[model samples]
Target: MIEYQTSSFSQDEIRQAAQIQIQELPQGFLSSLGEKPLALIFEHVATSQFGVMVIAKESSNNRVIGYVFGATDTGQLYKDFLIRRTFQAIRYFLPKLLSWDRITKAIETLFYPARKQQKRQDQEECKAELLDLAVVQDYHGKGIAQHLFGEFVEQLREKGVGCFDIPTTAGLDRAHRFYEKMGAIKVGSVIVHEDRPTYIYRYIIQTRKHG
Candidate 1:
């Protein structure tokens, strides 16, 4: 059995989760951002005051099995945290500048038009952003992802976030299917490199009317 709870910004759990992301996911710059991926994840979680972090723990061992990270209102997410993470990235990647792949990847990551930042510029539509979601390999094929996303939508709804957006690479077919199943519409997409497209998906949460 697995139990879900809001994370308390526990470094250990976040570090464990980050390690999984680095090892399992093909994140261009994130893999090269810092010696410890946990630091970057922690910085974002800690600075994004109103963002959400949910953790799933196995009942038998009380170990974190999966996690989801998102924001309720992204208009202010980058206002304060961008500089710090950027500087950290620069510091870490400076030594590895000789690698062309690392250099190109860093440039791409820095300028990537993340949906949240774009939503902030709109100023009219209040949109939330699902930043990152991941489940450990061993925990795959379970409904943990669905449950986590369900709870995520509920939490964002409670905070008055009606519209949501997420950016994903074209290769993540499973994620595309899941978002489509959740009623998310593909708003737009941009081709970063040959055969590598970044698709933007948005989901609108219907608000309840009170009599």
Candidate 2:
């Protein structure tokens, strides 16, 4: 009953669906939301998947079950955010990478976790990222997440983008295992959240024609 659709950005449905599991999502996840009049990072999604963001719906109930948001063209956004938050980054990243294990264990104690984060120089090769993904608790175990992910990945593949990201919380071992089993690589964690038990993970999507 899940129906995938393009993100409107104006409809509260996407944000509402996300609120169902917002606390479970990562930080820096929605920093783009409040930045401008439009507020979200990706507004174009082909209006489908490649436009940057999308939402999944349940036809029978007419409810938005979940959503995944991302855009590859935001190098400037990340670069600017990092510069503006330089002090916080310096103060936090050191201990984060230093005590990754401990942080991973107590991530629920951490604030809204990040499903993605600042990237390294080498990772600039990666294009899109899974900023935040959430399915309503009542809709869990019904393959909703997979459906949403499939739509997003397929769209990115069509665009010729290869690599993407999926940030995870160590406390949510089940989630980490899910993405890994789905083919994502554990490149490492964000230095700021290493000690906090949260990590920024990555995945590669082959071209649509090839995949």
Candidate 3:
């Protein structure tokens, strides 16, 4: 049977679980974060600071298989991330000169809600933002994403969530498809900021039709 967990652990636990080893440069927003590991800080930000839900699954053997993290707009952590990154990039990051401008533009695009939903804005309510989601490579195509997402939605309702958000772009083909499969419809988007061209997607969460 697939088991789900939402317990909290310290930063060290996140690092060990994510299995991230590279010591990324302290540049841009990352730089402002100082010596803390990125993965742990991110987990903390989502669960503790943002009041986001954590959906994770483990096997019968008790090994982690997948997880998704998200938070409400009250945190506004994304905006703060941008400001910190700007300073870090200028000071320490060695970004690809060509890709730098484009990346910045994409960040800006994710800020504003897609204009397509302007008419429905009055009736809709704000929900948590899905900040991160991932499954172990070996566990791919096993309905783990769907399982975790289902549980997360239930948890969201318990938390009084009315809706949720996801950040994606047309360029991120895989992510876009995943959201589509989750029954998320696009509400807004913006062109990535550069000659190379890119776009960001903003998708809203739809509650269970029967529930």
Candidate 4:
């Protein structure tokens, strides 16, 4: 059996989640920052008021097997991370800035929300977003991801979010399929990092109206 709940941001649990993130998303930019820095990012998110991190654990062992984390306002999340984790962010990201390619990508990431707003002016802008979701390889096909996603969605709902967006690498067919299966509509695509295409999907939360 597996249990899922919002994370308390414990050091050990953050370490486990970071390990899973690096293992499952080796090519992601955050994973390139090394495990310790990645763990710091997880801790930051788990503690942020605008963010939510849900973890899945084995019932008997209480070992983290999966996690899904995102923010109620992605723009604010990034801004807050930069402001609150300034020293650590500089310590870790400063080294990566030495590479021209990485610098360009970082700039693009920093301005992504503004660019997205310009590109999708006709559509409703969704401030809320589902940033990352990952499950241990051994736990795949066990419905852990679904449970984690459900919990994250519930968190957003409780926060009164009407809709949210999910951006994933273009080639991740399994993830795309899962989002589609969960009723997320494909919105469009964008290039956030040079040479990498990302697909965007939006999900609307159906809230019942009280009579």
Candidate 5:
């Protein structure tokens, strides 16, 4: 049996689970968020308003087997995160910025801030996004991901969210199929980095009509 609950796991435990389950970081906006810092970021997101962080544990031994992180308003959460964790972000990013490639990329991004405007604009109607979801390999085919996602959607809807924006890499057929199975529609695609393209999907919640 498995139990689901709001994230009460420590940063290290969450990071370790992520390390095992999430093999690749989506390249583009999330390319810079490395493994070590990702855990810290999750910590922040878990506590933000409209934030959803849930963990699943194996009842037999009380071990975390899967987790999901989502937000009703990713844009606002990030803004607040920056404001609240200014020094922390600096502490984490300063060393990475030391590399010549990192410095060059930062400079280029600063000058080309308008490139991602379309993607940003699309978020105007998207009320939520599944920022991250992962389940341990050993637990595959056990319906854990399905349960976690179902709960996530339910929680977001309770918060008045009607639409969700989900992005996955172009080559991820299995993932694309999974979201489609869950009622997501292919909305659009955008190039995140220089050449990497990501497909954006939308899932709209149908509201009951009152006579």
Candidate 6:
């Protein structure tokens, strides 16, 4: 049996989630930062008020198997991570700066959203986002991803968010399909990491009517 919940996760659970992140999302930039740094980022997100993380665990062993984490305000989340975890972030990311490609990607990540905002001022409503969602390989096709998504949406609604965005790379068909299946609308596309094309999707939460 598997249990899914959004709460203050322990350090061990955060570590497990970080490992799964690295194993499952190998192509992501953060995954390349290594496990310890990723784990620290997860911890920061889990503890921050503007962020939310839903973790799935095996009920039998209380082992974390999957997780979906994001921030209510992605811009603010990054800012806080840089400010509050300055030293740690520098320690982990400084080594990667030796590569010019890494430096470019870092600059793009920091400024891409702002650039997108300038181009699409009409999409000002898309302040929140679903950052990362992943399930253990063995747990795929068991509906764990869907369940985690639902929980994340609920948490966002409770926090008074009306809409959220999801950005995925062009070739990730499965991810695109899943987002579409969950009723997200593809709004547009943008280039990130210099030449990598990414699609942006938006999901609007339907508010429940009070009788």
lDDT of 2 by residue, 77-175 (tens): 455434554565456443443555544533422322233333455545464667656777777888888877788787677667888866566677877
**Cα error of candidate 1 at position 169, Å:** 0.5
Provide the TM-score for each candidate, comma-separated.
Answer: 0.78, 0.63, 0.61, 0.94, 0.80, 0.95
Q: What is the C-alpha lDDT profile of model 1 across 126-191, one tens digit per residue?
A: 446787777888888798888878878877888788888787788889999988987888877655
Candidate 5 per-residue C-alpha lDDT over 1-211 given as tens digits, one digit per residue, 9 for 90 to 100: 8998775667665675556444534443334646655666777877778578888887798677888887787666766777888898788777768777677665543333243345567555674778777787788789998998888887787788888878677887888988898888988876644545768788887765779
Output the TM-score of candidate 3. 0.61
Decide which is better by lDDT, 2 or 3: 2
Tens digits of lDDT, candidate 4, 71-112: 998889889998899999888778867888778877898888
User: For model 3, how does the per-residue alpha-carbon lDDT over 1-211 read when each residue is reduced to its tens digit?
Assistant: 7776665644544553344212222223332433433454455544564445443445456555666666655345555555545555444333422365545644544544443235336646454666556677777788877877776677676676767766554456776788778877676553434333233334444555773
Please, what are the lDDT tens digits per residue for candidate 6 over residues 1-211?
A: 9898799688999999999999999998888878988998999999887889999999999888899998898888888888898998888778867788878888888876676677568756587889899998998999999999999999999999999999888889999999999999999887876667878899999997999
Clashes of each: 0, 16, 9, 0, 0, 0
Q: For candidate 4, list the clashing residue pairs, or say none.
A: none
RMSD of 6: 1.3
**Candidate 3 wrongly placed segments (more than 4 Å):** 10-13, 20-36, 55-62, 78-127, 191-211
The lDDT per prediction is 0.69, 0.57, 0.54, 0.88, 0.71, 0.88
Question: How would the candidate models be sorted by TM-score, starting from the highest?
Answer: 6, 4, 5, 1, 2, 3
Residue 24 of model 4 has an lDDT of: 93
lDDT of 5 at 83: 82
Query: Where is model 4 more than 4 Å wrong at Cα?
Result: 209-211
> What's the lDDT for candidate 5?
0.71
Candidate 6 overall Cα lDDT vs. reference?
Answer: 0.88
